[model samples]
Target: MTEKSFAADLKLYDVEHLLLAETGEPPVSARDAEARDRVWEMAVRSNPALFDGPVVACGGVEWEGPRTLRLFWARVTYRHYALRRVPGAVALPSLFVNVLQPDTDGRVLAVRMSPSTAAPGRWQLPGGSVEPPEVGAVLDEATLAGQAARELVEELGVEAADEDLRLWAVTRGENGSIGLTYRAPARAEATLHAGLESARAADRARGREPELDAIALLADAAELSGLQGAHADYLEQVVRRFTAAG
Candidate 1:
């Protein structure tokens, strides 16, 4: 089988229904497991904030029909991603959700990762790896929307009702990772800035660093070039789709 090229353009899908099915965790060989552990330990030494907490990974994806997709997921921890450094070891793709938070002027919000993060200084949407659902619970579109809304509140101090989030697009990017992008109700730019300041203060009060260090609102993909940092692979694609929709 040909290894998928990470350089390939991201594929976008207009998925209305995401049918999730569990395949459990991917099998890791003894050699790969040892290597993964070593890599993870080194990573932790470099960034103590890197947690091994449970997260979801995408095993595979299949199109069920028009506007519908069947996604196979697995429960894994952040450490599983370290397999990427173990040559010839196949790591499950990541599953995550992000919000395309836009201001009243139609500019989408992008945030810079703080020094404490795994991808420090990278610019991306406000989101994180999908946490595993509670025991015996199912992962679905509504659940994903709830996660997206919670991310905005946690990262930006912006409150959004779960029902208010709309699944805007699904994207497949490098390493076959899947990203679920949701559209949030537009808010005033001033309101967003105030929320960010409040959230930063709250984090500092807890003796922790804010997850996001800075933010920018862009009306189109062209504006992304002005941000001085590596960008999330799907950022440009998602931003283009957002701007073109207007």
Candidate 2:
């Protein structure tokens, strides 16, 4: 057996945050396109509390406080006409965050990968998948925000407090199966703590110290897209939306 690259098992799970719940691709028929438009329109007009499976949240969940806690609700989107079973579709809404920080000039907190990642050497915003409490995943909405700040510290060897971070806004995208999204902002530098054990280990194995080569603010939007793979595109789209709206 062979080991998969970090990028391999690194499941992008875009549907976890964007418009994705499962994975399947077929040529969109004219009828499919028309139906998709209708569904997409319904999704756009509908609140985030419509889709809730035992596993994923479809919409109508109430979020409370600064943490964005989405309490469960009903009136879920029970119709996924595309698949017999929803792949990444969750009964409950999952949580995730987009990290924003200042650059060396205190402008933007863009980042470069350590080349070990699938998007190695590309510029991207720091983020990850979120597993809600029901699934027993470590990261939730609030936790993801904290992780954003923590990732700043560990990846850059800086210390940033959760309070100082700013909440941008949550946006939703669906990949035909799953549906959800979140975006936030924060400062550039902070006091780093070796909180991410696996990330630190990966660095150590490579003979580099933790946060040795983590995220850094990019010069601007143009410099951010130079990265390779899905990560680069992911960062570009996410950051653009985040900054544009802000």
Candidate 3:
């Protein structure tokens, strides 16, 4: 059969398209099989017969497109033994965090950032991917207190002694590809800096301090629930343990 040229941007949608790249199933699992079936059904939702063979998905596929389109191929392969989407050439590194905080008023000090960030209009702890400059003494130091302290001063405009920060927890990727190390104030703070100018131009952008939006004292898990996404989940787990210890 002659290969038909597809459109530049063919769109595909299915349950399989929603597969989380980091979810608990194998790269291709039974869940993926189900997802693929759902996506196939969705494809046939229009024509009702594309499930029999390899149905071109996503207009011949663009290697430079979004991650979702590429995942359809894996789902189809695992479930229908077919091809629904084409692969893209993009490889984005999964993110790891370096959330830091201060202790005050029986409440874990948390900072909110400008929602204009990549996560968009959400609150997260102050931290990010570790820098190459932080590689020296911190490689063995899981908490990397020294680096966290420096980040506090540089990013958050807070002065924290290395000895004044404590490790709260270490969240690692399932396969241990990376770890999100958390640290918090060992004592009350004397001053705080937003690190707006230097931090923005240096790393994130210009004057992009999320912590500048609004900060609140979280009383308990119920109160902290006001936060969204993984940050909320992480704070619940970490702060609950903190409360139990006190």
Candidate 4:
């Protein structure tokens, strides 16, 4: 693979046309499978909260026309990503959805992953790995938007209609993972703060730690530099684009 294809920086694309097709999981060698299992066990030991839940993985993506992409995917568990640590393993890329929630002032919301969650301390938009749809169900743009909306409510306590969440952009970054970004309606800054507090409180009541530990409203990508911990690879690019448009 070319260096550019695996570059750490994210390549952003406008959401013009997207096609999703189901495909079989990438073949794994016996050695790689054993290594992957060992890595996942070690990870679980380190973070007991880790769950090997079902998720969608991006098999590959190809361009059919300008601003058009055809993405092949397969069902896999979170443990499948552990294969990335196995030598010579060609791991499939992760597929996830995130929402760009801006306040009325055009400041976008960014949240930090909690210690209990994977990627602890990393600041990113409110989102999670895309869960595979039930058997006989389909995965598509509308489904992705709905997942994004659900993430917004879970992380930020904001309820947005799935239809109102517009497909904004697509990003490829860390581990060649694919992300679908959605734009949500702007809300008052105070309202956002209140909602986050409520969400965190609810999680606590359920005896579970909140997925996000902190939140920030950044006006531009440069502000990301001021954050204490590492920033998600696609965050700066997404923030810059959102801020520049206003």
Candidate 5:
């Protein structure tokens, strides 16, 4: 498909207008199961600290414009991402909600993943994968905003009201992962730092490593270069867009 055609095919949906359908089964094979085990073993051997957990991944995306996108969801373990490195194997894209917080000074907040997690040391906004809604439950704008708020509280100890989040953009990464980015109301930078520190201390007290070990405020995209390790390809774009808008 031409670049123009591809762009045209992509559409943004308001959280309220988004439609999500459960696929009922994950995109995995017996071979994939075996590969997942082997890859996970190798990964744990390398880090000796990785945790395996259930995570939801996307099965497919159907764009029905006029402001709507339908997402097919699946329950997959975190190991599924490793299968992407296997030759001739395709892993379905995962959808996640990312919240961009700009401090009162206009610097954007980014977090560094802990060493025990997948994508350790990478810098990205605070968020997690979209899980399947409860049986008989409805997934809508309120549900998504609630999830975003939960992440903020769990990961950074920042309590943001659901109404304070505005769905700003949907970004697709080079590997097809989708990020539903939201803009959060700005707060004092000191307040953000204190909340994160408290969250990290609480995690340590519970004998668990926090999901994020470091946080930085990017005054502009140029500061992003100073962060160590890999980053989601779309992160730079998000930073630039937010910084420019300010």
Candidate 6:
């Protein structure tokens, strides 16, 4: 398969606008539904706490220019991710916000996902699936940035304001998932380490499993190959771009 390209310029339309323009239902047929159910059952058996929540995933993307892309949104249940590994199943591409933090020394921070979550043990930036806007509401750039900021604080214990995040690139994976990548202001490595440790301890105190168990600082793309588990297709490209810019 050919590798996908990343778009540096993005135009985010309101969720309401995208829904109005969306054409077809995601290609989930009865067979796909059966496959999803079987996979979901096994997933829940492994981790019964999984909840099928409502999420807004990217249904499609269109390039309007060399660097500009427009995103379309769709409503999907969290269970739809189970179909990702099922052969020939055309599931809605999950839209997630990935925040890449580069410290003053130029190392980018990546996290190792916890075993209880989907894509456990995978090394990637801190992020989560996009949730749908409230009924009759529209999701705009500020709201999306706010979600990214919240993920940083919750997962890494780093405090970054929404305006501090700059949407740097939008990458589409081979599986069709879209990652809205953002770059935040660089901080001291010691500060990041302390914040992460505090965050992990807080999770344990709350009786909740932290989403990430380990964190690594990568100075270049070559370091990514040393990490474990599957990574998003955009990981290397994002790391390279960030490192090069520094």
Per-model TM-score, in order, reads 0.95, 0.43, 0.47, 0.95, 0.86, 0.85
Query: How high is the lDDT of residue 171 in model 5?
Result: 78
Tens digits of per-residue lDDT for model 6 on 1-246? 111223444222112111112323477789989999999989889887688998877767665554455567877788988888689887777889889898889989988889888777888899988878887687777788888998999999999999998777776676567778777889898988898998999999999989888888999999998987777667788788778877
Worst 10 residues of 2 by lDDT: 1-10
lDDT, residue 15, candidate 1:
76
* Overall local distance difference test of candidate 6: 0.78
TM accuracy, model 6: 0.85
lDDT of 3 by residue, 16-81 (tens): 111212112124445555665676566566543232531111112122222222211111122232
Candidate 5 residue-wise lDDT, 1-246, digit = tens: 112112533433233345777775545678877887798889889977766766667676666664566767777776777787777777777778889888999888999998877778999999988655767887666787788888888899899999899887777775677777878889898899899998999899999889898999998888888998887777888888888978
Candidate 6: lDDT of 45? 91
Query: Each candidate: RMSD to true structure?
Result: 2.8, 14.3, 17.0, 2.5, 3.3, 4.9
Q: How many clashes does the backbone of model 3 have?
A: 10
Q: Give candidate 2 regions above 4 Å deviation.
A: 1-95, 104-106, 115-122, 131-142, 173-202, 205-216, 225-234, 237-246
Alpha-carbon lDDT of model 3: 0.41
Candidate 4: where are CA atoms >4 Å away?
Answer: 1-10
lDDT of 2 by residue, 1-246 (tens): 111111222222322221122312233456555565566556535544333232223333333333333423222223333222234323333333446554334345555565444234555555533333333243334554575666555565445667665554444433311222333333324422233344677669888644334444454456554544334434554555544544
Please give the range of 10 consecutive residues that has the lowest summed lDDT in model 3. Answer: 11-20
lDDT of 1 at 129: 88
Which scores greater on lDDT, model 3 or model 4?
Answer: 4
TM-score of 5: 0.86
**Clashes found in each candidate (C-alpha, N, C closer than 3 A):** 0, 45, 10, 0, 0, 0
Q: By TM-score, how accurate is candidate 3?
A: 0.47
Q: Which regions of candidate 1 deviate over 4 angstroms?
A: 1-10
